[model samples]
Target: MTTDPPPEPNREPTPGRLHRARTAFRRWRRTRPFWAAVWTGLGGFVIFFLPMAPLGKILQVGLGGIAGMAGGVLLMAMALLILLLPGQRHTAGVIAVIAGVASFPLSNLGGLFVGMVLSVLGGSMAFAWLPEKPARRRRPRRTTPSAETPVSLGSGSA
Candidate 1:
């Protein structure tokens, strides 16, 4: 049997799909370091416990693999958050960057700590920056002409 040739690397991705993909990719990449670090770190964590993880050998093995992937997702997720969150997005994004850097240590503990710190920072910034809406003013009550009139038409009193 003849082997099929591999697709060309230079073939351009379609603009529509490419644009969508680029958008998604940029989102993923922008948050890459965070997701990668987290996923990789978590993956390492799960992989290390594969033998004793009680989910059965299959699951344990699965988790080991998953843990490895967790680091990847962690980075992607971080990039994704930067894309998703607005306003203080740039500042919020640094957490992902730090986490991505920490991923080299291959430790989830580091990510957990960083995540906690970022969460507090995110909350505080949101609390401090959100503009409060002004209260609506109530209109003044109107006096009707009838109420001011002392004369009754039928009684002829003025």
Candidate 2:
């Protein structure tokens, strides 16, 4: 009987779909306003995890859970608007600023520290960011001095 061929050598495993997606995302560069909006939204989300409480109380505001959630939700909505509505970015920026200011009382000093900082940064960027225009390729004019053009030199020159 003929002998069987030897087994092939092991090969390295390929990256999974999720890994590829993450790599693509990392490679993608976003505009300043986009990054700002993402950061602000992230900050707002962080605030939601903290306990709802007044400045001194810190994370002890469980009694007003609904209110705390409401504030967080509002901030998230504004951030979404900033991202989704490019035309309304200015308006969204204004809202983000308001949310940052409100975060101090709504989520206490912790929110003020995190949420306010991120929101304010994002708001300012959104408000100030301008879309960049693509550069145009212009050909240098191929100009040659006209033969009829006059050139003056010392009268003694031949």
The lDDT leader among the candidates is 2
**Model 1 stretches astray by more than 4 angstroms:** 1-68, 107-158
Q: How far is candidate 2 from the true structure (C-alpha RMSD, Å)?
A: 7.3
**Candidate no. 2 TM-score:** 0.63
Give candidate 2 misplaced runs (Cα > 4 Å): 1-32, 52-65, 110-112, 144-158
At residue 137, candidate 1 shows an lDDT of: 100
Q: What TM-score does model 1 achieve against the real structure?
A: 0.26
lDDT, model 2, position 56 = 56
- State TM-scores per candidate: 0.26, 0.63
lDDT of each residue in 1-158, candidate 2, tens digit only: 99999999999999999999988775443433577678768767766655554655643554334445566677678778877776688888888777777777666653648866877787777887776666799999998879899766668856
Please give the lDDT score for candidate 1. 0.45
- Taken over the whole model, the C-alpha lDDT of each candidate is 0.45, 0.70
Q: Pick the candidate with the highest TM-score.
A: 2
